[model samples]
Target: MEATPRPSINIMTALLLLSLHGFIGPAAMAEQPSISADQASLLALKQHITDDPEDLLSTNWTETTSVCNWVGITCGTTHTSRVTRLNLACMGLSGTLPPQLGNLSFLAYFNITNNTFHGSLPVELSHLRRLQYFSVRGNFFEGEIPPWLASLPRLKYLFLNANGFSGTIPESICNVSTLQTLDLSENQLAGTILPLIFNIPLLKVIDLSNNQLSGAMPSSVFSESPLLDIDHSSNSLSGVLPQNICGNLPNLQGLFLSFNQFSGGIPSSLSECRQLQVLALSVNNFSGTIPRELGNLTLLNGLYLGVNNLIEYGSGGVVSTRGDVYSYGILLMETFTGKGPTDEMFSGEESLKRWVKNSLPDAVGDVLDAKLLSREELTAAKLECVSTILELAAHCCTELPGERKGMNDVLAKLEKIRTVLGQM
Candidate 1:
């Protein structure tokens, strides 16, 4: 009879148990949302086959997690959830760039410079509309630059230097009106400079050095903007340089045109750029008297007019052989003190060389940069090495060009000094 009443299996009780199971079962476990397309793109990059695999890059990469927490992935300043900068410079990463990087729509700065990356630049990068600073220099990338690069409306800096890239720089590069810096130096690119490059309204820094380019120096360059620096050195470019170069560029600071065939009178209008700091025109065919107006450039720090047919003039209206020397002395002071010359004698070639040579005997505490002087904890051996460097520079600046050591010798001496310093 008790079996008949068996557990009193009431329907209500069974229903209650079922309801509890529904609310407290394994099926109730929370599931994260699947990785978005942007995250998937990043994951694909992690799978790239590298010649020398970096285990550190893969330690925390996972499909279901936020990439913002990944190493080397810098997040946005305002919104930490989005990646803004990707700096993998000098990481020894070797692989074709994965197109998946374009998925990072908010990325503003991306630098993979000084790596072993090889292969054509992926056109898919055009999709990163917000990119501002993009640099992949010193890599083994080979191929024509994709024209799609010009389509990035927000790009401000682009550097593809020291790569194996071959072909003329695309004219479309100049179409990015907001570009502030563009460096395509040390490549196999050949052809005339694109005229459009001079037309960019915001371009401030440009380096197209060590290429096979040949043409007349564009007069329009720096004609419309406050370009601060320009380096077209070591190209086959020939012809007289543009006049009014510094006049047009009020903020012109550094100008490098060394190792070219440019010939003509130095532009007198250069004095207009009072902010000029470094002017390098060495190893060219420029002739005529050194513009006395150059002395007006009070902010000038490094002026390299050597190896040219430059005649110096003095304030007394006499042609002075010390003119070139004077400029060199200014540069020496700039390099040594990190400051402009305190007196005109420091701007004279012979005077500077003599001063440097005589000062070597008592050089330790006073001759060195003041900033470096504050380090009283420096060892005697370290001071000796630094004094040796100064001595070498002094020798290199000898009044007689033939007696002066060559740059190669100067560099070797500097290297030896560095080795000694390193040991100390």
Candidate 2:
């Protein structure tokens, strides 16, 4: 028996075989595709918009990648991928919304506010059944609001302020029982008030200011809800305000009815809202004396009742717009000291601002909320910062409205105080 000889191989032949094996390796790759509906939507958005020349989005956004790893996209505990939140706020995105965004079935939050997006809101948004928050304020969006939005079951927050939206608010909005915040201010919406909106039990904040809405204010707007804030200012609403405005809303924090045609006296029953903070009823036709009971609101912060036909309840006590100025000061104190107006500092007719200004040297700790004293572990510098804020509040709440600082001024001063506090 003779042995068979093996065939000889050259170096080039060996390299050719290696190359063939390498080509087959990719076939066995086990990774799933990373492209998601959200990614596709983002890509479409990038293509449609002319802004963001800095490539900020491209740097952090990619398809075939985990959306949880992408910027501004939050995920849940299970890490089951979904575009739960999309915060493109102030990103300067200048384009119309793409309808393909509806593909994100699990998206709960979508905020493209403070941008330059124009044109009508996409009807495709109705497909977002899980959407809880949708804000497009401070934009150029025009045309009537899409009626299908009423079908969104989980929608809790909807802000379309500072836009060009016209026509009456779709009555279907009342169908969203879970809605907590609804802001349609600074729009061109006209017609009478829709009573159905008052029936939503969970509504907490409703701002319809700066619109053309006319008619009597709805009586049952806050009847059965835990609404804490309501702003209907600068509208054409007529008739006297409901007497039991605060009677129903036990937790009412702010009530802004300024620049309207509301008539009658400031209701004494409003004192029942122990948690009342900001109350602005300026530029209305309110008459009669400023209720002495209002002074009993311990939690009151900003009280603006200027340009109204107000009188004092007690003899020799003249009602002045300065009361509002004093209230603003109290608000500043509340912000700095973290205390309500009735909290020890200004318990009686002795205004907080007056006491602090008159006794500047000795008044440093005089206006400090006693609540902060319990936290004895805080540093001395921190305590001084608190004192500085109280002094600043004193300056803001002067006896004259003209002398009292505006919100911008107060905020600037507070920022400075904050910066100093941060250094400490």
Candidate 3:
């Protein structure tokens, strides 16, 4: 009787079942219903990273884990897993980014900031049609930014700063019509910045500072961009600023144009930047007195007018903006009061500092901007805040240059004021 001739020859059913379910091993995962293209793409990126001392990639990205379960990889949940975000910023990961990263066609945010990754970007990265935020700052990446950069129609928020990238930024960079923030700062990039860069409608920041960029910022470039921040500082860029630099840019917030060859008066049009929070025009060839119109930038919070050829303004016999601490003090006084030193009310003997100083401590209401006094909510806490700042400003503008507080003292006091005011 024995064993009933062990069930046998079920090959047809086995074959059918295998076809329905497909392969499931780690090897088969390289293909079909198991691990998808997105997984393989990420694994390829992980392979190039020879040293991730933190074990971020090695411990998390393994066969037993779903790719979505791995750190630094976000996948869409609605469909089959597709990588959407890959951020390994400041992770001490070192290696080249291989072209396989392009296979993650659905990735939108990619940042490898503050790593030691070297070599040029892979051209295949352009395949990431959905890429929006791409930053590789503080890396050793060199050579021209990949030519395919222009191909990503949805690309915005590119930060290639603090890298060794050289060569002229390509004209095709303008092709990324959705670009919002373009920071090519602290690179060896040369050649005149392409004029059309400032024409991109969605651009919010243009930071080409500390490059070898030459030539004038084109007037046409200023016509369309309508950016919120522009920093063309520390370059060889020369030419008078456009007369209406702030007209088209109604939302302009920060303008840093220091340490260049720009020679001319600070444009009277700067008064038009009503929302400007900072105005840095130091170490340039800008001569003549600062335009009286500049005092109209009521929103200005940071003003760096030092290190220029402000000949008429100085202490001792020598003339220099740096030595003219009194003028800086006056500038500070005007900033808080929203009144120029030469306002019509200030007569031959009267001055902005003197007016504020006389009303100090008890009568802060008389010196602060009317807009500030109008806050209505400034019960006791905020009014006390105002008194301190104005007092500091008045101290900065004391009669003798030797008597005035040093800038470092002023800076520390301002930071204290900001902290006390809960603005820091």
Candidate topping lDDT: 3
lDDT of 1 by residue, 1-424 (tens): 4546556668878766876878544433322121255567677776773754566576666755576777667766553356788887877778888988887877899998988888988888999999999999989999887899999999999999999988898989888999999999989888888867866899989999989889887776545675788889889998998785665677888888878889998898888888898788877889997787999999886677765677653534544554444344335444565443334557644455566667675564466665454477556777777667666666555545546565555556768877876666
Model 2, 165-207: lDDT tens per residue? Answer: 9999889888889999999999999987787786678888999
Better of 1 and 3 by lDDT: 3
Q: Considering TM-score, which of the candidate structures 1 and 2 is the better prediction for this target?
A: 1
Give the TM-score of each candidate: 0.70, 0.67, 0.69
**Model 2 residue 416 CA deviation in Å:** 30
Give the true-structure RMSD of model 3: 13.1
C-alpha lDDT score of every prediction, in listed order: 0.74, 0.74, 0.79
Per-residue error (Å), model 1, residue 223: 5.5
How far off is residue 380 in model 1, in Å?
24
Better of 2 and 3 by lDDT: 3
Sort the predicted structures by TM-score, highest score first: 1, 3, 2
